[model samples]
Target: MRKLVMVSMLIGLGVLPACTRTTNTMGYIVDEVLVAEVKPGIDNRASVEKALGKPSIAGQWDDKTWYYVSRNTKQTAFLMPKPTEQSIIAVSFDAKGNVASVNRRGLEQVANVDPVNDKTPTLGRETGVLEDLFGNIGRFGSAGSAGGPPQ
Candidate 1:
């Protein structure tokens, strides 16, 4: 019986390592060699696109900037994924279609934003709950009954 328990324990120990999964990756996989070929001020949009392909995200309002984003996450078993590595390459262009700058950002630049729940103040007369509930009671009338139109 002791030998049986020892064998079962050994089997369980062997399976424990398999339970943890390998790192998972998502988004664009940046190649340093390809990125290096893009020279600031000299490389234009066409050349950059040819070298690095289309960007993951472009500037929200315009095409003046492009971003290549990549992230690597790891999770063991049922735990939430934690980002182990992240890369964001930002490329900006001038209005004339020439490369203006090339910059890189990491995970440290991520921001956590929490939205406020306060109602927006508007220019109107404020009314209490009872006034609001009964305010429109006598205001609504059928246009047909008022001789405006026929249905």
Candidate 2:
């Protein structure tokens, strides 16, 4: 019995190291994030794309301009830490396709708009997992529970 226990312990010990994601916790640091420098009125669309690849998002609101963004991330397991890093590079241009202004923002520098409270968080609403399991499936989504109501 002792030998069996020892073998199991050894196996468990070997498996324990695999549980972590092997990511650096320091990646969560805000300032450690790398953001590309933008040269005003010099970097154009082609140059921007060559340096930063494709952006996570791109658009224009008022005038003609192009934007590029990039994000990098690292994560860990358990209580260690959740590490994430990202950067957004904005390349704007005039109608003439000349670089206008560059707006670089870090995750910390961006403001949390609270989603404009568009879908206001329900007060005292049924948030229980079990409740949704049996609630209306057509109107409300399936409660995502075992033995939930039939489709």
- Best model number under TM-score: 1
- Over the stretch 1-151, how does candidate 2's per-residue lDDT look in tens digits? 9999999999999988777565443222222222344465776667755555555456745544454443454545555333255555566777766668877665674444555557866668556786679566555445565565555
lDDT per residue for candidate 1 within 1-151, as digits (tens), equals 9999999999999989977876988888999999887888899999999989999999999999999999998888778678889999999999899899999999997666555676665798998999978887667567767744467
RMSD in order of candidates: 6.8, 11.0
User: Best candidate, lDDT-wise?
Assistant: 1
Per-candidate TM equals 0.66, 0.49
Candidate 1 Cα lDDT to native: 0.88
Candidate 2: stretches off by over 4 Å: 24-38, 60-65, 77-81, 109-151
User: Which whole-number lDDT from 0 to 100 does residue 99 have in model 2?
Assistant: 68
